[model samples]
Each structure stands twice: as structure tokens, then as C-alpha cells.
Target: MAATVEYDVMMAPEEPERSEEEREREAETCKEKGNVFYAQKDYNEAYNYYTKAIDWSQKNASYYGNRAATLMMLAKYREALEDAQQSVRLDDTFVKGHHREGKCHLLLGNAMAATRCFQKVVELETKNEQARKELKNAAAVLEYERIAEVDFEKRDFRKVVFCMDRALELAPACHRFKILKAECLALLGRYPDAQSVASDILRMDSTNADALYVRGLCLYYEDCIEKAVQFFVQALKMAPDHQKARLACRNAKALKAKKEEGNQAFKDGNFELAHRLYSEALNIDPNNIKTNAKLYCNRGTVNAKLKNVCKAIEDCTNAVKLDETYIKAYLRRAQCYTDTEQYEEAVRDYEKVYQTESTKEHKQLLKNAQLELKKSKRKDYYKILGVDKNASEDEIKKAYRKRALMHHPDRHSGATTEVQKEEEKKFKEVGEAFTILSDPKKKARYDSGQDLDEDGMNMGDFDANNIFKAFFSGPGGFSFEASGPGNFFFQFG
Candidate 1:
């Protein structure tokens, strides 16, 4: 207690509070200093002095107007707009405040609002040439906004870009036109041009959320997904209610997660799960063509693993359609065609692949498809069996049984002679298919494009009727006529 009393005794007297008149004078002096700094292009120092003037005289419209001008010079249009608006609120008849407000509104793409502000400036001072010029620019901006809205809805991106360019010529400082032009350029696949426009805006105003979003879009189109997401996040941070940035960020994150999950599933040999995840990723942003192409190709790989060769081929074809230079899609589709004995189609795809990549692997694939095409001109046992060359023995047997039962001559005895003859021909073909494909040695020779005659087992030597009889025969004498197709059983000994 004694130490506290001794400290209080040594305390100095407080300075007296300044009178309102003194504060007003100090505020005017600070504003004059701000004007000097502003004239010298020292926007930061001008902003600080203007802020000090506003703090000293909170009701002074001129101080706020000066600060608004400094903010505009610093390219902080939104903040400038706030200060400009505050100045107008303090004194509605302040022409300079109204003019600054109009400028901020015009730069921010609020053409209607800017028009009102400039109209007020003209109402207060009829002969303001600068306000008249800004009003004309605002009118041009309105026309551009209208035209751009219509063209953008119709997906006429090129026309939108043209309109934006003209609007920008009238209001060169307008960020809205630049952002719209960049968005249209991205839609038109001019990613570099789009990036250039966005980067220019960012150089002046790094915190412009619309410009950041446009830059993200360009990066996204360029297949820089991670970098695009970063930009989108930054835009969202600057403007929490930015719907485009929010949706894009969500899609980018979901796409990346699904893609990674799909790849993990593929690595784990879970083809079904991988296919589903990849399909989900594709649906996340279907407009992202390059990303969707890779997803389609990945799904095709999963389909191939799942033994869905036709679906795999279809997916790979879609991948190729999305990105014609997708070499993996071409190679995968060619392999699928070759597997399915579509040698002509396989050769075409392989030729396309060879044109892109003249590697030995591609060359060999082309040669193999060409050889298969030549071989395909002859009797195709696998084709007759309705099975692929990679079909297992069990799959071959099942196909043979099904084909034989459907095409057996006895099954069509009630039909006309022409129908009976056709059924008999198909039946014989099925029998011959089973004869070659059911035997591993014969299947190996057939797959190698070798003649069975070289192994002393010519196609002519195999009796289709006898083979059919042996395939369906049971202990005493099984008859296909007595047992309908559905009632047939394997004659297990």
C-alpha cells in the first residue's frame, strides 16, 4: 500500500481533451496532407492520412471522400465503394463523393447503381463533363451486361467475349467485364488468353474474388486441378457467398477424393468398387472434359478387369471421344477389339495408336491386329461359339451347349424346309466351334492361326452330327427331341 501511494504521487497530469473546433482544424490539416500525398501518387500514405482525418472528424464527408479516392487508386474498389457511400451518407449533395461512388460502382460492374450515382452528381452540378462521360460508360456497361447475359445463357461464348471487349473499351477499369471475358475465353478453350485476362486483374487487385475465380477456371481447364482448387479456396475466403467458387471448390475436392479412392480400389483389385468410384468422379464435373476423359479411361480399365469387354470398349471409346489424343484409351480399345475378334476395328485403333506412339509395343500390336484380320477372313471358331479368344474352357462349353440347343435341327422341325435348313447349318457351325474350342490343343492351334490339317486333324475330318450326338448322348440313348432345350442335362458318368 505504501509503494502504490508513492507511485501515484509521481504520476503526471493528463493532457486536456481537444475542443470540437480544434479537432476540426486538425482533421482539415490531415486532409490537406492526404491531398498532397494523393497528388504525388502515394496512395498508401494518402489513405493513412485520410483515415486519420476521418478518425479526427467522423462527420466530415470530404475526409471520407479523400480516403475513398485513395482506396480506388490502390485498386481496393469494394472498400473504396464503402468509403464513397459513407461520404455520400454524411452529405448527400457532395458531388465529388457521388462521382467517386459512381466510379467505384462502375468498376465493380454495378452499372445501374453507378448510373444513379452519376445522375445525382449531374443533378447537383449540371456541367460536370466527367460525370457525363461516366454516365455514357455506364450506359455502355448496361448494354454489355444485357447482351452478355443473353449470349452466356445461349452458350455463345465468342459473342460474349466480343461484347465484353467492347464494354472494357468504354470502361477500361471495370473488373466485371474482364472477368466475364476471361470466363468466355476459358469456355472457348483459350486457356492462355483467359489466364492472361485474370492475371492482369489480379495484378491490380489481388483480392478480387471474381478475378480469382476466373483464374481458377483457367487452371481447371488446363488440368491443374490442385492449383485450381487453391485459387477457388482463396476466392471463397475473400467472398464467402461466392456461389461459383463454393460449388467449384466442392466439385474439385470431391473429384480428387473419388479419383484417389477409385485408384486405391483399383490397386486393391476391387474392380466393381473402382468402376463405381470412377463413375462418381466423372459425374462430379462432367464439363471438365480432360479430367472426365481420364476417369472414363480408368473406368474402362476396371471394366476390362471385370470381364466386361464390350462395356470396356464403349468406355474407352468415350474417353477417346473426350480426348482424341488419349493414347491409353486408343490402346485399351484396340486391345478390347482384338480380344473380341473385331480385327478390322482393332487394326484401325492400333493404326491410330501407332501414329501417336511408334513404340515397338504399338508396332507389334498393329502387326498382330493385321495378322488377326487376315485370320478373321477364314472360319472363326471363337466367333461361331459366341465367345472371345480369351474365353475359358468352361465358358466355351457353356456357350456351345446354349448355341447347340437353340439351333438344333430337331428343335426347328415344325418350321418350313428353309428354316430347318438354316437351323441345321447353325447347328453344324456350333458343333464345329465346340470341336475346335473345347480341345486345348485344337484351341491353341486355332488361336495361333494354324491349320488343323497340319496336325492331321482337318476341319473336314470332324463330323458335326457325330460330335453333337456324343455331346448330348447318355447311357442307353439320350434324345434331344424327347428332352426340350430347358430340360436337357449334362450326361455325367
Candidate 2:
């Protein structure tokens, strides 16, 4: 059995108290050490010392504020935010604490929260220039981010540049802004400018993954394929999971291979094969402006070689749509229309080429188009059919039948109903002209320059195909396909 000994409760004397002044003195020593570390840019060490000072004197707002700034420098943004909030909580009138909190939020990528903190700082201290500056910066960053995201989603590279420029003006030191600006410039085909921007970013932060990625894109655009691959490799080294860098590297390598293949094909005079290779490159990167433009222009040339004038015009039109300032597209489209005897459309495209091009060759092209337009308008149908003005009646009938069968609407079914109608009208006109010329009496009258409707053919007899063949195919010998829209000519003609 253990004896229960009664033990007297000994009351301990009150622990020695620290005077507020002594606590403050100890806090000052910690603060001084923090400032030394901060000046040396040892932000983590500075943060530790400043936090120690705050713990020593919980009521000192300045200690908490300084610690928050050090935490921000260390990129411990959430912790810095808490410390700054505590600072302002301890002394709500402290303008510096509010400003520090805003900075922490900004570093944390919480622009709206930063904005609120800055607004509060400005409200409490209207004349705090630093707070006002921070507020303006935060607002600009927020607006820029919003606009850039919207424009990027819309594929509006021009508006992206506008928004990113505003952001750069506000946050000149922001790597994110610089990267976005470079991307916009690349999209706009300002390769040289994009390269310069990317280089500047790399110079400032050599290990920056985004900067390396963007520099790779610029190099790829500039046709420096090998160098571009190196840049992407470096970016991957910095951030192994960078999807954009990996994609860019793969695309650049593919483009280089495709370009080589296309060049060889072009040199071998295999225009169709060359066009196919260029198309493949474009498919790898649809936004590749240079490749797309080149493909359009080259495809137009191939279509022309294949004697597909309308297809050539379509290809050239696509080129121009991809890049409105494509002078080659305008010129090629004009040539296609001219070859097809579409003089009015040719004139419009020629005018566009003239507006964009300053070369002497382009001036000559414009002059040639104008002259051709005038000549085409004056071509006579009778001269094109190659019949004598005074052939015998039997000979005239023979010639009319031969010409009608040769230029018959059944040969060109793809023409529109209007075109078929025009061809029929032309055929009737030729028949009537032959009837008048073939008759000895009527021929004599016509020879004397007298107006005579000798055939007496009614409007119903003058079919549309005759008119269209005489008007369009008369001079240029134009023809339509046999299986397309205007195949109604088989029933009527």
C-alpha cells in the first residue's frame, strides 16, 4: 500500500516582465538585421529577421509591414499577404501597410484583390504617390489581361498588340507582358520586331522559359530553322513540361523538311508536287502566314499551268484573303481573269495590284490590262466566225451549220441558263446574217449598206445559246464544262 503523502502547493512568483521599451529595443535589433539582409537582396533572410521583430512586439505595425515586403520579395506571396493584412489590422491608418498588401496581391497574380488594397490605400492617404502609382499599375495590368485574353480567343492579333502594349507601359518589368507582345508580333508577321522583343526578354532573364519559347517562334518565322530548334530545346531545358515550346520545335522541324521538299519539287519544274508540299507545311501550322501566302500564290501558278483559269483566280483570291497586302495575289488573279476574257474582273484586280505595287513590271501589267479591256470591248462577232460577206446561199447554210455545231451549247453544259440563252441568241443572229448575205438580192442590198431583216426570224427563233456563243466565245473561243449547272442547253439548243 502506497502512503498518500499530502504535498503543499507551492505558488510560483510572477515571471519577470519585459517593459514595452525593452521589447521595442529588441525589435529594433531584429529590424536592423532585416534591413541589412534586405539591402543585400537576401530576401528570405530579411523576411526571417523581420518576422522575428514582429513576434517580439506584436503591436508594431511597421515590423509587420516590413516583413510583408520581404516576403513579397521572396515570392511567398500568400504569406506576405497575411503579414500585410495583419499590419493594417494592427494600425488601420498605416498607408504603407495597405500599399504593401496590394503589392503582395499583385505578385500573387490576384489583380482584383491587389486593386482593392490599392484603392483602400488611396482612400486612406490621398497624397500617397506610391499607392496611387500602384493603383494605376494594377488597374492597367487587369485591363490588359482582360482585353488580351478576349482578343486572343477571337484570333485578333492586332487588338492583342494594342492590349499588350498598354500592359507593357504599365509594367515594363513584367516578363508575361513581354512574352504576349512577342506572340502578337509573330502572329502579325512582324518577325524582325518579334525577334527583337524576345531577345530583350532573354537578355533580362536568361532562364525565362516563355522568353525562350517566344524567341524560338521568332527564329522559326525568320527561316532560321536550326537556331529555332536550339531555342526551343533551351526552353524545354528550363521548363520540361512547356507544351508550346515542344509544339513549336516539332512544327519548325516539319516546316524545314517540307520547305526543302517543296524547293526541290519547284526546281524540278513539278509545280503540282511543290504546291502539295507547301500545303502540307501550312496544315502543320494553320496560322503560319508566310506558308499560307506562298501556297496560295504557288497554287494559282499551277492552276494556270493546268489551263484552269477560274481555279487560278480562286487560289489567288484565297491568297489575298490571307494577306490583303499580297501584291502577287492581286497580279496573278488579274492575269487569270484576263486569260479567261473576264475583262471587267481583271480590271478590278489590276487596279488593286497597281495600288499595292511600286515596281515597273506592275506598272506595265496595269497598262496591258487597260489596253486589253478596251480591245475586248470592241471585238466583232462576224469577224470571229470567219465567213465571207458574200457567200452563196448553199455555202452560207453549210457554214452556219458547221459553226453552230462547233460552238454548240451541248458542248458546254456547265454554263448558266443565262449563258445558254445568250449562246442560242448568237446562233440565231449568225443564221440570220448568213441568210441575208447568202441571198443574191439580199446580199446586194446588204452590200449597199441597207438595213434588212431578210430572214424574218421571230424573237422566239433567236435562242439564248446563239447570243451567248457570239457574245462570249465569239472572240476568245471560251467554253463551259459539259456536266455542270447550264446543262439545260442540251434540251433547248
Cα RMSD (angstroms) for every candidate in the order listed: 11.3, 16.8
The window of 10 residues in a row where model 2 has the poorest summed lDDT is 484-493
Give me the runs in candidate 2 sitting further than 4 Å from their true place. Answer: 1-98, 104-151, 154-172, 190-197, 219-227, 381-383, 386-493
Compose the digit string of candidate 2's lDDT tens values, residues 344-441.
88888877877777678878877777766765664233443466544556666566656766556575456898987776656555655554555577
lDDT to native, each model: 0.88, 0.76
lDDT of 1 by residue, 230-282 (tens): 99999999999999999888888888889999999999998989999998898
TM-score of 1: 0.57
TM-score of every candidate relative to the true structure: 0.57, 0.56
